[model samples]
Target: MKTFVKIMLAATIVLVAGLWFSNSFKALNNQADALEQPTEVIEQPIIEKTKIEPVKKTPFSETIVVETAIKFEAPLYWAVNDYGLIDGYSSTEELIEKYYLEFTEEQLARLFTEDFFYNEADGVHVTASASPNLIQTDRDFTITELNENQYQVSQVLYTLDDGETAYIFVDYIYDEVNNNWNIAMINYQY
Candidate 1:
Protein backbone atom coordinates (compact mmCIF):
# COMPACT_ATOMS: atom_id res chain seq x y z
CA MET A 1 0.00 0.00 0.00
CA LYS A 2 2.79 2.41 0.79
CA THR A 3 4.46 1.61 -2.51
CA PHE A 4 1.20 2.06 -4.35
CA VAL A 5 0.65 5.37 -2.66
CA LYS A 6 4.19 6.47 -3.45
CA ILE A 7 3.88 5.55 -7.12
CA MET A 8 0.61 7.47 -7.33
CA LEU A 9 2.21 10.49 -5.69
CA ALA A 10 5.13 10.45 -8.10
CA ALA A 11 2.86 10.14 -11.09
CA THR A 12 0.73 13.03 -9.86
CA ILE A 13 3.77 15.22 -9.28
CA VAL A 14 5.22 14.42 -12.69
CA LEU A 15 1.92 15.18 -14.40
CA VAL A 16 1.65 18.48 -12.60
CA ALA A 17 5.25 19.39 -13.30
CA GLY A 18 4.84 18.55 -16.95
CA LEU A 19 1.77 20.76 -17.21
CA TRP A 20 3.49 23.65 -15.42
CA PHE A 21 6.60 23.45 -17.59
CA SER A 22 4.54 23.28 -20.75
CA ASN A 23 2.56 26.38 -19.75
CA SER A 24 5.67 28.26 -18.72
CA PHE A 25 7.40 27.50 -21.98
CA LYS A 26 4.38 28.63 -23.97
CA ALA A 27 4.23 31.90 -22.02
CA LEU A 28 7.95 32.50 -22.43
CA ASN A 29 7.68 32.00 -26.18
CA ASN A 30 4.73 34.40 -26.40
CA GLN A 31 6.72 37.06 -24.51
CA ALA A 32 9.67 36.53 -26.79
CA ASP A 33 7.48 37.08 -29.85
CA ALA A 34 6.00 40.24 -28.34
CA LEU A 35 9.46 41.70 -27.75
CA GLU A 36 10.14 41.60 -31.53
CA GLN A 37 13.91 41.85 -30.79
CA PRO A 38 16.65 39.42 -29.92
CA THR A 39 16.91 38.93 -26.16
CA GLU A 40 19.72 41.02 -24.68
CA VAL A 41 22.48 39.27 -22.71
CA ILE A 42 24.01 41.80 -20.33
CA GLU A 43 27.20 41.20 -18.37
CA GLN A 44 27.20 42.13 -14.68
CA PRO A 45 28.85 45.44 -13.73
CA ILE A 46 32.10 44.25 -12.12
CA ILE A 47 33.34 47.61 -10.82
CA GLU A 48 32.33 48.40 -7.31
CA LYS A 49 31.30 52.09 -7.15
CA THR A 50 33.01 52.85 -3.80
CA LYS A 51 36.24 50.94 -4.67
CA ILE A 52 36.50 52.59 -8.09
CA GLU A 53 38.18 49.42 -9.47
CA PRO A 54 37.00 46.66 -11.85
CA VAL A 55 37.33 43.36 -10.00
CA LYS A 56 36.92 40.07 -11.83
CA LYS A 57 34.02 37.96 -10.57
CA THR A 58 35.37 35.10 -8.45
CA PRO A 59 34.44 31.57 -9.57
CA PHE A 60 35.07 29.96 -6.14
CA SER A 61 31.52 30.20 -4.83
CA GLU A 62 30.08 26.86 -3.80
CA THR A 63 26.51 25.62 -3.76
CA ILE A 64 24.43 23.41 -1.44
CA VAL A 65 21.49 21.31 -2.61
CA VAL A 66 18.90 19.87 -0.22
CA GLU A 67 15.91 17.62 -0.68
CA THR A 68 13.36 18.78 1.88
CA ALA A 69 10.26 16.66 1.35
CA ILE A 70 11.12 13.42 -0.44
CA LYS A 71 10.90 10.34 1.73
CA PHE A 72 12.74 7.05 1.30
CA GLU A 73 11.60 3.65 2.55
CA ALA A 74 10.70 3.91 6.21
CA PRO A 75 13.06 2.21 8.64
CA LEU A 76 12.53 -1.53 9.14
CA TYR A 77 11.58 -1.79 12.80
CA TRP A 78 10.38 -5.04 14.38
CA ALA A 79 6.68 -5.44 15.02
CA VAL A 80 7.64 -7.40 18.14
CA ASN A 81 7.51 -5.77 21.51
CA ASP A 82 10.34 -5.61 24.03
CA TYR A 83 12.76 -8.49 24.92
CA GLY A 84 13.25 -9.55 21.24
CA LEU A 85 10.77 -12.38 21.63
CA ILE A 86 7.28 -13.05 20.38
CA ASP A 87 5.43 -13.37 23.69
CA GLY A 88 2.84 -15.86 22.41
CA TYR A 89 4.75 -18.81 20.90
CA SER A 90 5.80 -20.58 24.10
CA SER A 91 4.67 -24.13 23.27
CA THR A 92 4.40 -26.41 20.24
CA GLU A 93 0.62 -26.17 20.25
CA GLU A 94 0.79 -22.45 20.44
CA LEU A 95 3.28 -22.41 17.59
CA ILE A 96 1.00 -24.64 15.53
CA GLU A 97 -1.98 -22.42 16.22
CA LYS A 98 -0.04 -19.32 15.19
CA TYR A 99 1.29 -21.09 12.10
CA TYR A 100 -2.12 -22.34 11.02
CA LEU A 101 -3.91 -19.03 11.14
CA GLU A 102 -0.99 -17.57 9.21
CA PHE A 103 -1.27 -20.05 6.27
CA THR A 104 -4.84 -19.64 5.03
CA GLU A 105 -5.52 -18.80 1.37
CA GLU A 106 -5.88 -15.35 2.72
CA GLN A 107 -2.35 -15.90 3.96
CA LEU A 108 -0.74 -18.83 2.04
CA ALA A 109 0.20 -17.13 -1.23
CA ARG A 110 2.66 -14.92 0.54
CA LEU A 111 4.36 -17.73 2.49
CA PHE A 112 7.32 -19.88 1.41
CA THR A 113 8.82 -22.77 3.30
CA GLU A 114 11.85 -25.06 3.74
CA ASP A 115 10.44 -27.33 6.42
CA PHE A 116 9.74 -31.06 5.66
CA PHE A 117 6.32 -30.80 7.26
CA TYR A 118 4.27 -28.95 4.69
CA ASN A 119 0.52 -29.05 5.29
CA GLU A 120 -2.62 -27.14 4.46
CA ALA A 121 -5.24 -25.48 6.66
CA ASP A 122 -8.84 -25.47 5.34
CA GLY A 123 -10.63 -23.88 8.27
CA VAL A 124 -10.37 -27.19 10.17
CA HIS A 125 -7.78 -28.83 12.37
CA VAL A 126 -5.85 -31.64 10.62
CA THR A 127 -4.65 -34.81 12.38
CA ALA A 128 -3.40 -33.96 15.84
CA SER A 129 -0.27 -36.17 15.86
CA ALA A 130 0.69 -35.08 12.35
CA SER A 131 1.52 -31.58 13.61
CA PRO A 132 4.25 -30.89 16.06
CA ASN A 133 2.87 -30.76 19.55
CA LEU A 134 3.55 -27.42 21.07
CA ILE A 135 5.99 -29.12 23.42
CA GLN A 136 7.72 -27.03 26.05
CA THR A 137 10.03 -24.95 23.81
CA ASP A 138 11.82 -21.67 23.61
CA ARG A 139 12.96 -20.05 20.36
CA ASP A 140 14.30 -16.66 19.38
CA PHE A 141 13.22 -14.75 16.31
CA THR A 142 13.54 -11.31 14.80
CA ILE A 143 10.45 -9.53 13.53
CA THR A 144 10.88 -6.57 11.26
CA GLU A 145 8.19 -4.30 9.91
CA LEU A 146 8.89 -3.64 6.20
CA ASN A 147 6.12 -1.10 5.71
CA GLU A 148 2.38 -1.45 6.00
CA ASN A 149 2.33 -4.30 3.50
CA GLN A 150 5.48 -6.26 4.27
CA TYR A 151 7.45 -7.83 7.18
CA GLN A 152 10.63 -9.96 7.51
CA VAL A 153 11.43 -12.44 10.27
CA SER A 154 14.53 -14.28 11.50
CA GLN A 155 14.33 -17.31 13.75
CA VAL A 156 16.44 -18.07 16.81
CA LEU A 157 16.52 -21.55 18.41
CA TYR A 158 17.13 -22.42 22.04
CA THR A 159 17.37 -25.60 24.10
CA LEU A 160 14.89 -26.63 26.77
CA ASP A 161 17.18 -27.37 29.71
CA ASP A 162 20.90 -26.53 29.67
CA GLY A 163 20.58 -22.90 28.41
CA GLU A 164 22.78 -23.65 25.34
CA THR A 165 21.48 -21.75 22.31
CA ALA A 166 21.82 -21.34 18.54
CA TYR A 167 20.65 -18.61 16.17
CA ILE A 168 18.71 -18.68 12.93
CA PHE A 169 17.30 -15.90 10.79
CA VAL A 170 14.23 -17.18 9.00
CA ASP A 171 13.21 -14.79 6.28
CA TYR A 172 9.44 -14.28 5.95
CA ILE A 173 7.54 -12.30 3.36
CA TYR A 174 4.17 -10.75 4.14
CA ASP A 175 1.48 -10.00 1.57
CA GLU A 176 -1.85 -8.15 1.67
CA VAL A 177 -3.47 -9.49 -1.53
CA ASN A 178 -6.38 -11.26 0.17
CA ASN A 179 -6.96 -8.42 2.60
CA ASN A 180 -4.95 -10.40 5.17
CA TRP A 181 -1.41 -11.42 6.08
CA ASN A 182 0.27 -14.43 4.39
CA ILE A 183 3.72 -15.98 4.44
CA ALA A 184 5.92 -15.44 1.37
CA MET A 185 8.94 -17.58 2.31
CA ILE A 186 10.93 -19.02 5.16
CA ASN A 187 14.56 -20.16 5.29
CA TYR A 188 14.65 -21.49 8.87
CA GLN A 189 18.41 -21.59 9.26
CA TYR A 190 19.26 -18.63 7.13
Candidate 2:
Protein backbone atom coordinates (compact mmCIF):
# COMPACT_ATOMS: atom_id res chain seq x y z
CA MET A 1 0.00 0.00 0.00
CA LYS A 2 2.95 2.47 0.76
CA THR A 3 4.63 1.80 -2.62
CA PHE A 4 1.29 2.43 -4.44
CA VAL A 5 0.75 5.74 -2.56
CA LYS A 6 4.33 6.97 -3.46
CA ILE A 7 3.83 6.13 -7.16
CA MET A 8 0.49 8.02 -7.16
CA LEU A 9 2.11 11.12 -5.57
CA ALA A 10 4.99 11.13 -8.14
CA ALA A 11 2.49 10.75 -11.04
CA THR A 12 0.41 13.70 -9.75
CA ILE A 13 3.54 15.99 -9.58
CA VAL A 14 4.61 14.96 -13.17
CA LEU A 15 1.05 15.61 -14.45
CA VAL A 16 1.02 19.13 -12.87
CA ALA A 17 4.47 19.96 -14.38
CA GLY A 18 3.41 18.73 -17.85
CA LEU A 19 0.23 20.84 -17.69
CA TRP A 20 2.28 23.94 -16.67
CA PHE A 21 4.82 23.43 -19.50
CA SER A 22 2.01 22.89 -22.04
CA ASN A 23 0.21 26.04 -20.92
CA SER A 24 3.45 28.06 -21.18
CA PHE A 25 4.20 26.68 -24.66
CA LYS A 26 0.63 27.52 -25.76
CA ALA A 27 1.05 31.13 -24.48
CA LEU A 28 4.40 31.58 -26.41
CA ASN A 29 2.88 30.14 -29.61
CA ASN A 30 -0.05 32.53 -29.33
CA GLN A 31 2.35 35.48 -28.86
CA ALA A 32 4.40 34.38 -31.89
CA ASP A 33 1.26 34.09 -34.04
CA ALA A 34 0.14 37.54 -32.98
CA LEU A 35 3.54 38.98 -33.97
CA GLU A 36 3.53 37.23 -37.39
CA GLN A 37 0.08 38.59 -38.35
CA PRO A 38 -0.10 41.78 -40.48
CA THR A 39 -0.73 44.94 -38.48
CA GLU A 40 -3.58 47.26 -39.50
CA VAL A 41 -2.42 50.89 -39.99
CA ILE A 42 -4.99 53.63 -39.34
CA GLU A 43 -4.84 56.39 -42.01
CA GLN A 44 -4.37 59.97 -40.74
CA PRO A 45 -7.00 62.52 -41.74
CA ILE A 46 -5.85 64.90 -44.61
CA ILE A 47 -5.60 68.64 -43.88
CA GLU A 48 -7.40 71.13 -46.19
CA LYS A 49 -5.03 72.97 -48.62
CA THR A 50 -5.11 76.81 -48.73
CA LYS A 51 -4.54 78.69 -51.98
CA ILE A 52 -1.46 81.00 -52.03
CA GLU A 53 -1.35 84.12 -54.20
CA PRO A 54 1.79 84.90 -56.17
CA VAL A 55 3.61 88.13 -55.36
CA LYS A 56 3.23 90.83 -58.01
CA LYS A 57 6.42 92.57 -59.07
CA THR A 58 6.49 96.31 -59.80
CA PRO A 59 7.07 97.20 -63.45
CA PHE A 60 10.16 99.28 -64.14
CA SER A 61 8.17 101.93 -66.03
CA GLU A 62 5.34 102.22 -63.45
CA THR A 63 7.60 102.07 -60.34
CA ILE A 64 7.38 105.00 -57.89
CA VAL A 65 10.34 107.39 -57.99
CA VAL A 66 11.43 108.59 -54.54
CA GLU A 67 14.28 111.08 -54.64
CA THR A 68 16.13 111.52 -51.35
CA ALA A 69 18.41 114.54 -50.85
CA ILE A 70 21.69 113.37 -49.31
CA LYS A 71 24.10 116.18 -48.43
CA PHE A 72 27.75 115.11 -48.55
CA GLU A 73 30.62 117.39 -47.51
CA ALA A 74 33.46 117.20 -50.00
CA PRO A 75 36.85 116.21 -48.61
CA LEU A 76 38.96 119.22 -47.68
CA TYR A 77 41.84 117.62 -49.57
CA TRP A 78 41.19 115.53 -52.68
CA ALA A 79 42.81 114.87 -56.07
CA VAL A 80 42.35 112.58 -59.04
CA ASN A 81 44.82 110.95 -61.34
CA ASP A 82 44.57 110.90 -65.14
CA TYR A 83 42.36 107.84 -64.84
CA GLY A 84 39.80 109.72 -62.67
CA LEU A 85 40.45 107.54 -59.61
CA ILE A 86 41.05 109.23 -56.24
CA ASP A 87 44.77 109.94 -55.94
CA GLY A 88 47.02 111.24 -53.18
CA TYR A 89 48.72 114.62 -53.26
CA SER A 90 52.29 113.67 -54.17
CA SER A 91 54.52 116.60 -53.19
CA THR A 92 54.54 119.17 -50.38
CA GLU A 93 53.50 121.65 -53.03
CA GLU A 94 50.51 119.52 -54.00
CA LEU A 95 49.60 119.09 -50.34
CA ILE A 96 49.46 122.86 -49.98
CA GLU A 97 47.70 123.37 -53.29
CA LYS A 98 44.96 120.94 -52.31
CA TYR A 99 44.66 122.62 -48.88
CA TYR A 100 45.87 119.40 -47.23
CA LEU A 101 48.79 121.19 -45.59
CA GLU A 102 49.30 124.91 -44.99
CA PHE A 103 52.77 125.73 -46.24
CA THR A 104 54.31 128.17 -48.74
CA GLU A 105 56.69 127.28 -51.58
CA GLU A 106 59.65 128.94 -49.87
CA GLN A 107 58.80 127.10 -46.64
CA LEU A 108 58.42 123.80 -48.53
CA ALA A 109 61.70 124.30 -50.37
CA ARG A 110 63.48 124.97 -47.08
CA LEU A 111 61.83 122.04 -45.26
CA PHE A 112 62.05 119.31 -47.93
CA THR A 113 65.71 118.52 -48.39
CA GLU A 114 66.81 116.88 -51.66
CA ASP A 115 67.82 113.94 -49.44
CA PHE A 116 64.28 113.84 -48.03
CA PHE A 117 63.23 111.92 -51.16
CA TYR A 118 66.18 109.53 -50.79
CA ASN A 119 65.15 105.91 -50.14
CA GLU A 120 67.19 104.33 -47.35
CA ALA A 121 68.05 100.63 -47.61
CA ASP A 122 65.40 99.78 -44.96
CA GLY A 123 62.78 102.44 -45.64
CA VAL A 124 59.95 102.29 -48.17
CA HIS A 125 60.23 104.82 -51.06
CA VAL A 126 57.47 107.42 -50.74
CA THR A 127 57.21 108.10 -54.44
CA ALA A 128 54.30 109.56 -56.47
CA SER A 129 53.02 106.14 -57.57
CA ALA A 130 53.23 104.77 -54.04
CA SER A 131 51.95 107.99 -52.40
CA PRO A 132 48.26 107.51 -53.20
CA ASN A 133 48.07 104.21 -51.33
CA LEU A 134 50.16 105.35 -48.35
CA ILE A 135 47.92 107.92 -46.64
CA GLN A 136 44.21 108.56 -46.47
CA THR A 137 42.92 112.01 -47.48
CA ASP A 138 41.30 112.62 -44.09
CA ARG A 139 44.25 111.95 -41.74
CA ASP A 140 45.69 114.77 -39.59
CA PHE A 141 49.36 115.13 -38.66
CA THR A 142 50.99 116.27 -35.40
CA ILE A 143 54.18 118.30 -35.61
CA THR A 144 56.42 118.68 -32.56
CA GLU A 145 59.72 120.53 -32.36
CA LEU A 146 62.56 118.33 -31.04
CA ASN A 147 65.41 120.88 -31.01
CA GLU A 148 66.26 124.37 -32.20
CA ASN A 149 66.40 123.27 -35.86
CA GLN A 150 64.75 119.84 -35.83
CA TYR A 151 61.06 118.93 -35.67
CA GLN A 152 59.23 115.60 -35.63
CA VAL A 153 55.93 115.32 -37.51
CA SER A 154 54.00 112.13 -37.02
CA GLN A 155 50.66 110.88 -38.29
CA VAL A 156 48.59 107.72 -38.34
CA LEU A 157 48.47 107.26 -42.09
CA TYR A 158 46.19 104.73 -43.74
CA THR A 159 46.32 102.83 -47.00
CA LEU A 160 43.64 103.82 -49.49
CA ASP A 161 42.11 100.54 -50.68
CA ASP A 162 43.27 98.17 -47.93
CA GLY A 163 42.34 100.51 -45.04
CA GLU A 164 45.59 99.68 -43.20
CA THR A 165 46.98 102.25 -40.78
CA ALA A 166 50.65 102.83 -39.98
CA TYR A 167 52.66 105.13 -37.77
CA ILE A 168 54.50 107.56 -40.05
CA PHE A 169 57.46 109.61 -38.79
CA VAL A 170 58.77 112.66 -40.58
CA ASP A 171 61.88 114.47 -39.39
CA TYR A 172 61.98 118.11 -40.47
CA ILE A 173 64.72 120.75 -40.37
CA TYR A 174 64.00 124.41 -39.83
CA ASP A 175 65.67 126.72 -42.32
CA GLU A 176 66.14 130.25 -40.95
CA VAL A 177 66.43 131.77 -44.45
CA ASN A 178 63.07 130.36 -45.60
CA ASN A 179 61.57 130.80 -42.12
CA ASN A 180 59.96 127.33 -42.35
CA TRP A 181 60.61 123.61 -41.76
CA ASN A 182 61.60 121.03 -44.38
CA ILE A 183 61.31 117.26 -44.38
CA ALA A 184 64.70 115.78 -43.61
CA MET A 185 63.59 112.15 -43.45
CA ILE A 186 60.39 110.10 -43.57
CA ASN A 187 59.52 106.54 -42.73
CA TYR A 188 56.46 104.51 -41.72
CA GLN A 189 56.00 101.40 -39.59
CA TYR A 190 52.83 99.31 -39.61
**Strongest candidate by TM-score:** 2
- Give per-residue CA lDDT, model 2, range 46-116, as digits (tens): 99999896544322110111100000002212334333223444443443344322222334333432323
What digit string (tens of lDDT, one per residue) describes model 1 on residues 1-190? 9999999999999999999999999999999897997778999889766856554432211110001000000001211433223333443244345554443222322231112122333221222223221111233334566665455554455444766654443222333433434434433331
Model-by-model lDDT, in order?
Answer: 0.38, 0.46
> What local lDDT score does residue 6 receive in model 2, on the 0 to 100 scale?
100
TM-score of 2: 0.29
Tell how far residue 188 is off in model 1, in angstroms: 2.1
**True-vs-predicted CA distance for residue 150, candidate 1, Å:** 2.5
Every model's Cα RMSD, please? 28.2, 24.6
lDDT of 1 at 57: 30
Return the top candidate by lDDT: 2
lDDT for model 2 comes to 0.46
The alpha-carbon deviation from the true structure for residue 14 of candidate 2, after best TM-score superposition, in angstroms, is: 99
Any runs in candidate 1 off by more than 4 Å, and if so which? 1-140, 146-148, 159-165, 168-172
